[model samples]
Target chain A: MIIGEQKPLDEIQGLLEDAEKVLVVGCGTCVTVCFAGGSREAQILSSSLRMSSKLNGHPQDVSDVTVQRQCEWEYLDEIEKEVAEADIILSLACGIGVQAMAKHFPEKWVVPGLNTTFLGIPVEQGIWEERCAACGDCVLGLTGGICPIARCSKSLLNGPCGGSEDGHCEIDPDIPCAWQLIYDRLTAMGREDNLLELQPPKNWQVSRDGGPRKIIREDLRLISDELES
Target chain B: MSGKDNGYLVGSHLEKMLRAGHFAVTGELGPPQSADPAVIHEKAALLKGYVDAVNITDNQTAIVRMSSIGAGTLVLQDGLEPVIQMTCRDRNRLAIQADLLGAYALGLRNLLCLTGDHQIFGNHPTAKNVYDMDSLQMVQMVTDMRDKAIFQCGDEFKGQTAKFLVGAAAAPFADPTPFRPLRLAKKVKAGANFIQTQLIYDIEAFAAYMEKVRELGLHEKAYILAGVGPLKSPGMAKYMKKNVPGILVPDEVIDRMLEAGKEWAGKKAADLSPEEKKARSKAWQTEGIQVCIDLIKEIQKIEGVAGIHIMAIEWEKAVKPIVEGAGLYPRPEVN
Candidate 1:
């Protein structure tokens, strides 16, 4: 899942400074699970902005609404009315949600209120750690399920760099060294032979380097009138 | 590809020494946290002729410092060869390539591609990590720049591409130690010409690692420099054993340090004054240097070992003595 955190109140306030009508939109998916830009967070931010703006002697109108999942156009369509009513749409969702909202409502000025961080999942309550780099390729089978691209400080395919000490990364004592974990996991699984083979250079063209990627499942595509004709 | 195809930059004495099979000796210098060129020059000058090359670390341990390129340039000015250490923690490929070009233009040749220490380990725990590519990719990219005159993205270099006697790091003691040599082989295949390993307090473990490296015939592909460092004190040993990851400062070394302070240890812990404590620390530090010198000697006899990389962290002054004691001084004057 994508993890993100709301921008600081002052930065958001600065971005929304000139607006008289502000519409705060939230996402119910990843941001909700991470307790970031979800519905509750949007409401709290709306109230805080109202109180702060009122304190600053220029009270602005604020409205809050949440889409089921802001990344999907169908879910985002539910908030078209609220978005059209506001002077600006402040998306309290991941960066993708902001872009999706902007794409759906091309007229309104859509701004991101959160900084999208990484693709991660909750490691524990109140703690989330990155788990994937979405490198357009995966090597988990060879690495004992630990994603070196996401976890190793260097994303080294064949490491445990010299900095990895005691199963933790040299960068931080708390963050477990991804390579160390891979080595341990591979040893336990008795698949140590998998690591001996050198992984070839990653083809970045399949990753973001190739430019924005899209998935097309021709088999799953609906046959519209134009296609049928 | 062989080292010849690796396209080593001109005038790297370390490369010259390694290629000449003269038991290359290298040293590490962590550019100060502050931006003082004089400090860099002074520290580098300490190891000026003692070691073949000096490694200028890039924000090692994630602490912000004068950039490694900046410090390495100063090292060059001091008439010492500088191995510019580049980490993947802070820069994307564009910035990394740009910096490498800048470093090469400034007459620095040797480059140690590292996956830098995580930001969380440094003062800036909240800083976003920009691991655009891991060190493996970094090495491969450098190799491409040197060998093919092309970027990893397949764009041809306009002109005058940077050539480097590329290097990378190793952790012989990292857990699942059996696989460590295999990891080293991968780095070598990725284009590392030399490898400076993490601190080796356990010579037995390192010897075992070297055995695997030799068995796989990786030693023929890359120069393997065993990293050895002087411990400042028993407290320092304990701190590293507790905090620093991958480094195994064997309990025996710590026991030696404790023995160094037996005079002070016999008294009440609170009875010792600051000066007394400093004296005890001095004793431990002296013993630490002796131990490092001994380790270097033992490592020199190990099969597949190229040389020693003495990391006298912040104690650059101790580098010369350790090298002399270990009989690594009078570094070969490579053409």
Candidate 2:
């Protein structure tokens, strides 16, 4: 659950004040679980915009449609008919969903309805917090399932930096020291020896630093050129 | 009286009672996103004579539904008071205030100001939010409209004066710090005449909450309608306990339902194979009805409870029975 808060309605209205025919689109993925943008949100926004427009006497023809997953091409295909009719597409998905909507419907203008916040989980009902960073690496085996990249202010790979005081981060007292939590968990599991092992600095090449990344599976690949020809 | 003036007076009286100690009941119905209005109309009709007012939720929880204004107009056309739920998740104050005025013109008198659920929780995650003003400020704006007949911090209204039964929501268990009562007070001071709280299950905790409300002098200031939604099934009970925010489901209530389960002997029937289906069906129906009646009874006992807002959702037909079972009758004269 990537925890995030909805942006104010006025800010969203401001972005598309000029749009005549508005299409409020929602994603059915990460942002939906986090309560930011999903099909439900898209519909709400579409209704709100329509009502707001009528109230203001600007009266734009506002419509709504939701894609199964805005991040994928297949889901975006479902709303191509609706997208074609609208002047602007207001996406209620996360950053990925919004970008995907933009990419799939290049002819229509796409506007984001939610502020993409952080990768987190609903720790309790109605409360969500950050949990992952998708740093393109997994060190949970060594750190007892906590990712320092997200919890640690410094994203320190080796260990806690000098900024840690009494097992709490110096930047914010409310935040627990990520390394301390890791240390405690490891010690509890009787794997304290794991921390003593020297680990090299994480290589950024495999992450977003390497630009757009792609994964290919030989078994899943389709031999299209020969068949199409 | 003009149809418009009658609507205004109805709204005004409701607002006055809301400011007083009178309990209020309000229910919500979502409008279809499309032009079809039959479903919205039918639901509004069923709730018309029962509730103090019906709320046509704009985009509750950010899920798209029918247009609230259109629904409000339909409700008004049917001679029922409609509480227009306006969320700031999709509009600025300029638009919000404008809608207030537009709703007023449409003969829609009641308004429930909300900040709206984050779009992320709905079907959309990447949607931009517009929080130009929160629910508090919106309440204040409505109050200002009533008193000055003008926009807050702006010029006077050039047209007929607009009045609204302004209300806001409070979630007692929403925050760890329990800011609901204090926030309710703030909304009152800002011009909120009534507060509709989130669904509550623990009467003891709610009674304790009322004690705090009395201490804060909010009991005397604004109408506080305890929100109650009947748990139709054991699954609903579990969902409310685990998922719904600011809800406190007591262990005793769960135990009672479980006991009811035993009396039906569904577990034993399940072992018999042939009786399993019948037993399962009987258990679900019995438990659902029992939970509904139990919640209403508990809520009726709480002090300082001005009234109860029963949210039956698609189960509007069960509302009358629940209210009657809880020993409440429609106070047609009150409204």
Candidate 3:
């Protein structure tokens, strides 16, 4: 799941400066699961903004609405009225959702309320750790299901560098060494032979280096008659 | 008129030293956290003739300091070679390439590429980490710029390209010790000309690593310099064993420090004066230097080992003694 954290109140307030009738939009998906931009968080943010404005002696209209998934247009269409009525729409979604709001409501001032952090899941309640780098090419099967691209400090293909000590990364002694975990998992599975083959340099063209990525679903897209003919 | 052989101060002394089949000794000088050139010059002067080359660390331990390039140039002014250490933690690809160009333009030649320590270990834990490329890739990039004069993006340089005698760090004592030598081989494949390993205290473990290194023929691919450092006290030994990653200060080394302290206190280990305790601490450091000299001698005997990198750390004054004690004085001039 995509993980993010709310921007500090000062930054959010700066984005909402000189604006009246602000709409704090939330995502019901990843950000919600991570307690970042869910409906509950939106409510908290609305109240906090109201209090901040009251203390500053300049009160403004602030309200919130959450969509099932802000990235999809169909779910976003449900909040068209609230978005149109507000002077500014503060998106609590990831970077994708913030762009989606601006694209759908072109004239409205849409700003990000959350800093989209990483593609990860809750390791424990109130704690989240990144597990994937979305590098486009996946090598988990070869590395014992450990994502060195995301977890290793150096993102080494053939690692545990000399810095791996006591199963911890040299970058931070607190973080578990990704390559160490891979070695342990591979050893336990009796797949130690898998690591003997050195992995070649990663193909960056398949990753973000190629440019902004897109996916098309030919099976699900509506076919135009002219094109079909 | 290649950048590798020309326009570089000291003319790649380390490369010359290693290629001449001489045991090369290098030292490390962490740039002071404060922007004080005097401190760097003083330390550089101390290590000027003691070691073949001195490494200027880049934000070592993740703590911000005077830039390594700035410090390296100062060392160059002191008439000693400097190894400009570059880390991927703070710079993106473009910035790293730019810095390398700048470093080379300043008449510095030797470069040590590293995947820097994470920011969490430093004073500013909240700073973002930019591991745009691993140390292996950094080594490859430096090699490319030197050999092909092309950037990682295949862009050709209009002017002189940054040619470096590239070096990388090796950890022989890291866990799953059998794979350590294989990692070194990979770095060599990536174009690392030489490797300076993490500190060595356990000679048996290091010997075992060297055995693997010889078996794989990695020593033939690149010069291998064993890292040796003076442990200041019994407390430092314990801290390294418990907290410092990739370092194994064996219990025996700690026991030796304790024994040194006991000897200093005349067997009455308790109720010593503050002055007496200070003396004992000095004794600990002196004993630690002896251990370093002994370790250097031990490592020198290992086949395929090129030389030693003495990281006196903050104790710059101690390098001369260790070098002289280890019979490495009058460092070879490989002009």
> Which number leads on TM-score?
3
TM-score of 2: 0.57
Give residue B117's error in model 3 in angstroms: 1.3
Task: Tell me the tens digit of each residue's lDDT in model 3 across B50-157.
Answer: 999999999998899999999999999999899999998898788999998999999999999998887878888888787777788888888889888899888998
* Tens-digit lDDT track of model 2 for B1-335: 11244443344545545544455566666777677778777887777766767778887767777778888898778776778899867886678888888888888888888867757666665787665565776777777787677785568988776677777877765532133455566667776767788787888888888888888888666677888876655556777776555577887767666665664554454466557656655666556556766776776667666777777777776666666665555644543
Estimate candidate 1's alpha-carbon lDDT, on a 0 to 1 scale: 0.86
DockQ-based ranking? 1, 3, 2
List candidate 3 stretches off by more than 4 Å: A4-26, A31-66, A80-116, A122-128, A137-144, A170-174, A185-229, B1-11, B155-161, B263-274
DockQ of each: 0.40, 0.02, 0.39
Name the top lDDT candidate. 3
The 10-residue segment with the lowest total lDDT in model 3 chain B: B1-10
Chain A TM-scores, per candidate, are: 0.95, 0.88, 0.96
| All candidates in order of lDDT, best leading | 3, 1, 2
Q: Residues A104-140, candidate 3, lDDT per residue (tens digit)? A: 9999999999999999979889989999989999999
Better of 2 and 3 by DockQ: 3
Give the C-alpha lDDT of model 3. Answer: 0.88
Q: Among all windows of ten consecutive residues in candidate 2 chain B, which has the lowest summed lDDT?
A: B1-10
